[model samples]
Target: MPPQVVEAMQRPMVPHRGPEFSEFYIALIERLKRLHRTEAEVLLWPGSGSAGWEIAAVNLLEPGDVVVAGVTGDFGDRFALVASTFGADVRRVELEWGNAIVPERLDAALRAAPGAKAVLLTHNETSTAVTNPLAELTAVAQEHGALVLVDAVSSAGGIPIEFDAWDVDYLFSGSQKAWMCPPGVAIVVAGRRAWERTRETGTHRFFWDMDRNLEMTKKGWTPTTPPISLLYALDAATAMIEEEGLEAVFDRHRRLGDMTRAGLGQLGLRLLADDAYASNTVTAFFPPDGVEARTIIDRMASEFGITLAGGQAHLASSLIRIGHMGWVDDEDIESCLTALNDVLESV
Candidate 1:
């Protein structure tokens, strides 16, 4: 958690149903809307980022509906799995792990799948560190008369995403990632069209129902026991972001990303993704020859007290990931890189 966000969570708890909480809730919603770059209602949920997938799936998709899913990495694959679990006929437009999901493939898939209800895209695939071209994909989805849904868990505040400008119908993110808050809360933004589609769907939903969540939001409260402390942390984190200005925050991430990637290149590491689609929040790279990713990760944490992430699943032993988002500074990146260089030499 960010320092200010941790401090905010330490404040004495307030009754979640009262006017005091109502003001806090409303203010948080406004901040979330600003972060989302949308005028749509932003729904808050006391759940992990994975819940965002379930909520979006249950709300907008009914059994037997066709959906065009763009899968570039693990999270993208998860979205497709969620859609399939909901009984949607998912046409998966897959790409190599390090590659971005281009609009042409999605347009082709959506065109072939007549009456497709939605096109699911992962804005930033954290696993592979590839950021998809959201604007172009959203335009293609619209051209094919499909609702655009995005999982922006790792990129929302770390990079600039114009939700309204892209006409995105449904998008969700986690508070723990770019929001610079702790886990346990997720934000979901639904455009009017998405809400209408939810109403038309016959999917049985209780806790994740958008209609109920919207009504409670209008009343400035939640239907169930909310995670008040996490909300406070989110409020504080968002305040800091707003104070610094969103554009400035994005530019900071962009600079940090470039610096980190250049430093990695200087160390003779192989990046997972191409320069055009590399993510600003996280970078995945192959270890130097004869050095395993686990060897570097373990040595970094055990010796230097710096932790690095290994690739997921089959790529686990093949590559390493370094995160440079959410309150990270140049000094932090430099220290990590220095430690990484030491680890490489030791290996």
Candidate 2:
């Protein structure tokens, strides 16, 4: 951990209702608003990114109520499953595993489900390494009067998400991704439309409660005990992002993607996604001829001290994904590429 972050966590514990804790909580929320670029309410939940998933479902979805979503990859499919657990009639407009949800299909699905309450989509499908055009697809959702909930866990901060400009109803992200911090803190940013819908929601939730989160935050604190250490870490991460400037951070990730793509292209490796739809944080590549991806990733980690990630499901044997979101630079990219080349030669 960084020195400043260690110091923040080492500070004396304050009562949940104490003046110090209250002040810090309020200040932290304000900082998040600036970082998220939203005038909407930002709720910090004390669990992983999936906790925000449940919160969104409970707060907006109801049993038997029809919900429509674009299933571009595993994240979107899992998000629909969670919402369906709330008893919502989840309808999916699925694309092939390697492709994104086309805007035309998204619009058609909304029109098909006339009374749909919300439409779920992953802003960036980490499984397939692709970024969706939220701006265009949200326009289709807004036209149908359905609230848009985006899974931006791997996309937010690593890329640009225009919350206010796009009129996104609800957006969720976590600190583990581009925020460059440890996990355990998930954020939910909701616009007034989604908050208003909460009055009619009957999904029944407590710890991951959003309505009470809004109410208790009146005093600048959570309704229950919070994760004090992770909270401190999140604040420090936000400060680090601010110091780097958001555009510069985005550019760094973009350059990483560009360089990785170039390197993989030079290596004659097959990319899983098209250039236009590729994710800035993760890039998936099919191993070169006569080479197994798992072997390359394993050897890179064990022999060269270079840890890399393999693809999911069908692409596991063939593809390896390079995650270069936070705490990564050109040198790290070079190291991964060099080690991958060496591993392929050895294999």
Cα RMSD to the true fold for all candidates? 0.8, 1.6
> Against the true structure, whose TM-score is highest?
1
Candidates' TM-scores?
Answer: 0.99, 0.96
For candidate 2, what is the TM-score? 0.96
For candidate 1, list the clashing residue pairs, or say none.
none
Q: Find the candidate with the highest lDDT and give its number.
A: 1
Clashing pairs in 2: none
List candidate 1 stretches off by more than 4 Å.
none
Off by over 4 Å in 2: 1-12
Cα lDDT tens digits for candidate 1, 1-347 = 67799899998889988999999899899988998788999998899988999998899998799999999999999999999998989999988899998877887887799999899999999999999999999999999889999999999888889889989999999889999989999789999899889879887899999999999999999978889999999999999999999999999999999999999999999999978999999999999888788888999999989879999867978989999888998899999999999888878
lDDT of 1: 0.91
Clashes of each: 0, 0
Question: How many backbone clashes can be found in candidate 1?
Answer: 0
